[model samples]
Target: MSNRNIQLAVLDMAGTTVADGGLVLRAFDIAATAAGIETEGPERDRARRYVLDTMGQSKIAVFRALLGDEDRAQQGNLAFEAAYDALIDEVGVTPIPGAAQAIDALRTAGVKVTLTTGFSRGTQDRLLNALGWNDIADLTLAPSQAGRGRPYPDMVLTALLRLRIDAVDQVAVLGDTTSDIGSGLAAGARIVAGTLTGAHDKDQLRAAGATHVLPSVGEFAELILASRI
Candidate 1:
């Protein structure tokens, strides 16, 4: 049983639990080029850097920042989704080692787990379908289900509400990026953990307000179950 008061675990999908093998960046290049970001140059380079920097944010939101115009942003988002889905079909997605077992352990410990992502609902579903994770968690959320995505606290808050969590203090959130940390912090979750399996480093996660940093999602169950907090 868990020693911590954490009742809900809001986990990020990609990088944190799912390993896409750099498919995100690969898909971004294809979509950006199609959306007129240029095949290669300073503009493409800057946009690519932005995508890296903003890992864990909603895809549409990222495209909005990159493309500026709403129409262009929507187009780019669609293109990104298409490209990402195609890649998934071509190469498939895999779970980070021990991720599924970790989640099962958490659930067995009486913690409600909700998988979350900045990807669109369709893409999120595709990932779940690809991994055969359709019933893996108590719930799964995408940015569309919530009003906003990471760095805004919407998805985390939505999970808390939908899961009937007593309070933000009773929640533990984990992910592999600073944006994930930021969302958890903003939602007032007591434990906001950053894992090293994805983008960003320890310093970056801490700077973004992570409460703890773990090596990967495989270690998250122990941190929560053994918690004395």
Candidate 2:
């Protein structure tokens, strides 16, 4: 069995630490349609599934998976970005309930905090700046920075290296998607599932190999404290 005393906490953005109300999916739908993918019925459902399955993956990987061809993939990615930027202009995103507080608490407890996401560096920076989180993050990494994406453990390993941590077993990863859990599991870290972000329900998270599924990050804070005590 692995130790319960975690020294590092790696978090996934989007559905895990932030609440954006399916903004990414909406953007992909619009972009896919613009790319001549025909977003209707089975195709639409397929696209949605593809997006969900590729949540923690790099944007390039997502595009490649969905569009297949390099040219079409590039076009689809550009369209997605344009669509996402437009959506952001109309609707701003916020940190999920207790998300900031959870990070703060973890830091106070001497736990290193790192954020891992599949967003492009430019796009991720814009979102964080808009949320007024320009300085709160201890360590932030995007797909561009990691050089690899989720379900592969590259992002998590990068975060671990940045924190100068040596034991993968001493890390805990929190996310709301299956890819997030899979990445954590792949990295040999304890996985905590956050259901309040609406990425998936508790059952889905558990099925993805999460050690525990808490309602929100706030509840997760309480649990972490209790475990320490």
Candidate 3:
């Protein structure tokens, strides 16, 4: 098919597009510590594991899983938000290598780009604005807008709707986690997995049903270009 036939490209935020480098985890640590949960050595490891295992899940869902109860989770979430907001300035967040160029190329080729993230709208906007990406994305869909979260395909479907794309074959979902791959597969979109991002390795991504496992966003862009050719 021609490049013009591709209508949309749905991208995941955290690991797929931006390299936050454990900024979210650090926020969780601050929140957990504020909640009187000590995070030292093994405990810290466990907390990190929890974050990694649920990388693509909604922020609320991740909080609930870590805090163990809805009430506690709410409290922790508040702390996390405060800590994240405060540290966001100091936190090193850069677009993943080749991400900007790839996105530009795609847009120049008439591909609509939609970003689906598990972050709250407030947080997502903050990050985008801070990174000078406020106008770079065609549409930004958040988990808060979805009734259900990752592993459920709600956000991905929402992005598709925003893009006004009916056929899943004309869209590609690119992400770096099992949840991401699962959501894309569930939505019947072509899945391009990124390994240099999220916690998932190539085998894990493939196991989750990724159509293509690429080393980085740049490689994925090359694949997309080749497909058009």
* Top candidate by lDDT: 1
Instruction: Give TM per candidate.
Output: 0.97, 0.92, 0.90
Where in model 1 is the C-alpha error above 4 Å? 1-4
Residue-level lDDT tens digits of model 3 in 91-181: 6578888888888888887778888777778888878887899888789888888777787878777877777776777778888888888
Q: After superposition, how far is residue 106 of candidate 1 from its true place, in Å?
A: 0.7
lDDT of each: 0.92, 0.79, 0.78
| TM-score result, candidate 2 | 0.92
Candidate 3 Cα errors over 4 Å, as ranges: 1-4, 41-45
RMSD to native for every prediction? 2.1, 2.1, 2.4
Query: How much is 133 displaced in model 3, in angstroms?
Result: 0.5
* TM-score computed on alpha carbons, candidate 1: 0.97
Better of 1 and 3 by TM-score: 1
Clashing pairs in model 1, backbone N/Cα/C closer than 3 A:
none
Put the candidates in TM-score order, highest first.
Answer: 1, 2, 3
User: What are the per-residue Cα lDDT tens digits for candidate 2 across 96-154?
Assistant: 87889998999899788888787778778777887788776789888778777887788
